[model samples]
Structure formats: structure tokens, C-alpha cells
Target: MSVLTPGDWGIEALWSALQPVWPGLSVELVDEIGSTNVELTDRLRRLAVVHAGGQVPDDAVLPVLLVARRQTSGRGRLGRPWLADPDSALTASLCLPIDRADWSGLSLAVGVALANALDATGQHLGLKWPNDLCLRDASQPLGRKAGGVLIEAVNVGHRRIAVIGFGLNVRHQTVPDRPTGALTEIWPEATPPATLARVMPALLQALQRFDQQGFAPFLPAYAPLDLLSGLPVATTDAQCPAGIARGVDTDGALRVQQGERMHRIVSGEVSVRAHATELPPAPGH
Candidate 1:
């Protein structure tokens, strides 16, 4: 693995681009960490303790952008391990105070914004329901996991702070059963720093919009990029065993058609798998 300094990431330029969307936002890059999400969440938890003393510092509530060049114990949805080689993936977390009453669809909004920012035309990138980012190509129409989002929040005093973490394969791999996609496939020259610069601004803006208007505005934008739409899916929830995905509702809950009943599967309720009756073909099979 090669070493990368803060200069390589252009912290100053990234901070400038993100400052307009989130004032007082700070950016920091580290050589290695356990997990960006865990780090940010822990920071807010510690800050919450300070708030109880009624002597919280001004910077305590300010937003921060933390990037890790390599993650030793990265995590995904359902506590799945997210493994990435040093300099082989882009892993970052953004922590900021959120004042929204209803936090539903926040992950979907982030997915839509990232998909648009990376591929505005929706040529090769697609979103899988709540939080997974997949690749769409002729070789694999069902799409493969390229990245994902994890949102966690903590209450500090009277304010709520959200830690939004994401990780994307840069020059990764495709195993026999678990296929993966990389940023290089879409952008031949993609690197961690470059990729972060491309998506951060749009992500920050989308978060702001979600905080104000909620997820209703992102419904239209999420339609075409939805990977589970019109596909037979199986879920872990006993209530909705199998159904054809009808896409997500206004609140970001997944709508599945089960017989004559349309069941709504909220995030964190169950894990979904595409093609319940048939498995997707492995790459080069």
C-alpha cells in the first residue's frame, strides 16, 4: 500500500466545496482506521457527555468529514464485514447535526444523490432499494454490489447528530459467488481522493434538501435507478415472504406486491434478495 498525505486529497479544495452546503464543516484524512462510521459516532457520543455539563464548545456541534485510507474492521448493513485493501476503496463518514422531525428516506436520498453525481445519465450505476449501490451492464443485468451506505445517529443535549458513512470499491475484486464492481469500471482514472471530491458536494446538498423537505422530492429521481423494481424478491421477514418489488413509497419504505396485498417493508425490518425463484448468474459463467 502506498502512503497518501492530506495534500494528495486536496483537503482545502474539498473543504471549500463542502463549506457552502455545510458551514464550519471540517475535513480530515487518516492513513488507517477501524471504521469511519464508528469513529464519527463515537465522537458524537463523547460530545453528548460534555453537553450534560452545559459547557459544550462551539466546535462540538460542527460537522466533520472523516476519510480513511484503509479500514481494518469496516462494517456494512446487518453487521456484515466490509473488507477493503489499503488504497483500494473510498471509505468516509460525514457527521453533522440534523434537525429533521422525520428521518425516513434519508438513506434513499443519499443513494439518489450519489448515483446522480457519479452517473447523471444512469448509464452504468443503479441503486438497490434502501442503501446498496450496484453496477448495471450488459454482462450482468441484475447488478452487483459496488458500494453501500450506513446511517447512524446520536442525540447530544437537545440536538441530534447523524453519522453518514459510505464505502465504494475502487480497484477491488469479484469473487466466485459474490460479484463486486469498482469505480475504475466507470471512471478509468478513479482514485479515493478524486472520487470523494466528485461525490461530497452533491451528498452534502442532498442532505440539506432532505433535512428541509424530506424524501418526497427524491421519489422521481429514484425510479429509474431502482434495481429491485418489478423483480421477484425474497425477504427475511415472515410477513412478506416473497413479492414483486413495486419500488419505494413516498416515505422510502419498499412496496412489494404480494398476491392481492401490497406490503410495505421498512428499512431495518428485513433483508431482501432479488430473484427469489432463480439465482443470478455468476460473472463469466
Candidate 2:
């Protein structure tokens, strides 16, 4: 692994590329942090407190991209620990305001954006239902998870702030019982700085499109990349004990075929595991 310096991130270059997409965007890079998502959420919460006092300005909630060179206590969906070796992953969080009546498939939309951005040809990368980026190949069969997305939203006065956290393993690492995948498996030249630069613009654009059109625009793009499609799966929800994965619905819910009925597994409701083989535990339960 190449040693990454602070200059490798190219903060100004990224700002030049992404500033127009999101006005008042701020790009910040830290040497190390506990969790980018937690930090951003805490910042937003403080802003919210300020707003309650009528002292907050209108431009207070500007879009922010927080990058951590080394994240010590990173988190994944469902309150699981996402541990990554130093300089081995692209760990960051994006905070912005999203105005939508329904946020059902936002995470799926984000997944599609990241997958398409990182692997435009869709040959080596695909999405696991809800919010995981997995490797596409015959060796792993059902696709091995190489990255993931975790989103947390908070109501700030009249607006809503959504903090989207993402992690992509750039180099390979060995975890005791957790089988992991790395971007280098497909892109041998993958690096944290370059990888972040590759995906940020697409992610910003996707969020903008999602705010206007919702998850409908991303459904077709997500289909070809659905790793769990047509695979037998089991979930924690008793209502949908075991079934075959039949892709996702318009709202991004996991469509599971159980006997003669179809069950739409909503996000955050239950944990799902593909039964085609004894898959490793996902980033989150």
C-alpha cells in the first residue's frame, strides 16, 4: 500500500469540481476521526440548537463533505462496527438537506450512485439490497461486500438534514471471522484519494436528482446491479421467514417471494442473509 499524504486528497481540486453542483459546499479532510457520520450529525444538532434560539442564519446548513483519512470507530447500518485499517479504506460522510415526502429508497439510490460511479461498466461491482456495495464475480457467487452506505436524517427546524456515510475498502485486509472484499480485487490501482475523487461528483449529482425525482429514477439503474436477485434468502422477520430474492420494488423494498405470496421487506425492519451459501455477516445485521 502506498503511504497517503494529506496532499494526496486534492481538496481544492475536489472543491473546484463539486462546488458548482452544490453551492456553498464545504470539503473538509481530517487526519483521523472516530466517525465522520457521528461528527457531522453532532455538528448539525448543534446548528439545530442554535436555530431554536433564532440566532442561526439562513445559510447555516450548507452542504458538507467530511473525509477521514483514518476512521477509528466507524459505523455501518443497524448499529454495527465497521473497522478498517489505516489508509485501507475511503471513509467519509456527506451532509446535505433533502426535501422529499418519502425517504423510502434513498439509501438504495445512494448505493446505485456509488456502484455506477466506481464501476461504470458494472463488471466487477454491484449492490446488495438496501445499502451495500459488493464485488461481482463467479468466485464469490452471491457477490462479496466491499463497501457500504449508512444514512441518518434529523429534522432541523423547517428543513431536514441527511448525513450519508460511505466506506470503500481500497486495499485488502484480514478480519478474524468477517470475510471482506477490496476495490483492488477489481481495480488493481485503486487508492483512497483517487477513489473518493471518482465517486463524490456522481454522489452529489445523484442526491440532487433524488431530491427532485425521488427513487423512481434510480430503480432501472439498480436492477442490473442487484446482487441478491433470484437467490434464496432468510431474514429475521418472521413474516418473511425464508424465500427467494425477487429484486426490489419501486420504493426500494426487498421483494421476497415466499411460497405463493410476495413480501416487501422494508429497510430497517429486519436483517437479511442470502441462503445460496453461508454468506459472511454483512457490514451490519
Task: Evaluate model 2: give its TM-score.
Answer: 0.92
Q: Write the per-residue lDDT of candidate 1 for residues 93-184, one digit (tens) a residue.
A: 99987789899999999999988988889988999878999888566655778899999989887778889999988877544578888888
Q: For residues 60-133, write the lDDT of model 2, one tens digit per residue.
A: 88889999988889999888887666788999999998988788899999999898998899988888878889
The ten-residue window of minimal lDDT in model 1 covers: 276-285
Cα TM-score per model:
0.91, 0.92
Over 4 Å off, model 1: 1-3, 53-59, 139-141, 174-176, 268-285
Best candidate, TM-score: 2
Provide the global lDDT of candidate 2 against the true structure: 0.84
* lDDT (CA) per prediction: 0.84, 0.84
